[model samples]
Target: SQQGEEDPQALSIQEGENATMNCSYKTSINNLQWYRQNSGRGLVHLILIRSNEREKHSGRLRVTLDTSKKSSSLLITASRAADTASYFCATPGTGGFKTIFGAGTRLFVKA
Candidate 1:
């Protein structure tokens, strides 16, 4: 059972613009994380925002959490063609030490 579910199933943006993706979950979570995956490759951890934290930033990525709403968002600034990939939200759940991922948002940054 996937813990998080992402919105806007797909996205297309011009390079240098910003891309934002959202996730919503069901159940109480201790932490939420965002990840990026290039085609035919493994996911790369982008950022982790805890339930107690509202916002966090790393490089061009910004993550925000609102446990009250069971929602989170990831913002990527100055997007590039290289940023073309699928983004997913993850949560560790009762799935027995497994992390479940939401249906990803496929982003295409047009050059």
Candidate 2:
């Protein structure tokens, strides 16, 4: 499967702490994207790293890609209670418009 799966389906942390998640896939992909969704809100794009890229960072979030192993990781530093939400990893489909989302890692950041 070209789709990837994330470890630790759930996570809980105190405000100001860091959270890390890992993902693994079975096949090659064009790029991988991280998204955040709050409760009922729509998924918000966090970052997108192409296959050739090794690492990327944005604000308090850091993402790393290892195409040789077909895996990736996302790390969020200094998390806030407002950061409490479900995070997902997606890989664009062959058709481009389609992307496959994993079950997601629900993160709860307590104040």
Candidate 3:
């Protein structure tokens, strides 16, 4: 049931610093996706990495997957105040219509 869990429930970083968050899942998955939520708004897809992929990057975001350990990590380089938001990991369900999300890592990028 509980698919993923992200550590250090909250993080605070300087504007130019880097932020790193880790996620661990309980079961096997086809793929894992990371999303960003700005305040109360909807989530925006950040990146997706398949089970076979080791690492993926997008702009200031870098994601790494380790299926053997059932874990993933997201690194945000040169963080900005705009990047201050909650980051969540989602994994599609077996049926594909539903997705499970970790509680999330709340990031605070001080301007």
lDDT digits (tens) for residues 6-105 of candidate 3: 9879999999999999999988998999999999899999999999899999998999999999999999999999999999998877788989999999
Segments of candidate 3 deviating more than 4 angstroms: none
- Pairwise TM-score winner, candidates 2 and 3: 3
True-vs-predicted CA distance for residue 91, candidate 3, Å: 1.0
Expressed as tens digits, the lDDT of each residue in 1-111 for candidate 1 is: 777899989999999999999999999998998999999999999899888999999999999999999999999999999999999999987855878899999999999
Cα lDDT listed for each candidate = 0.94, 0.91, 0.94
Q: How well does model 2 score by local distance difference test?
A: 0.91
lDDT sort, best first: 1, 3, 2
Q: How do the residues 45-108 of candidate 2 rate in per-residue lDDT, one tens digit apiece?
A: 9999999999999999999999999889999999999999999999876777889987788999
The C-alpha TM-scores of every prediction are 0.96, 0.94, 0.96
lDDT of 1 at 101: 96
When summed lDDT is taken over every stretch of 10 residues in candidate 3, the lowest stretch is 89-98
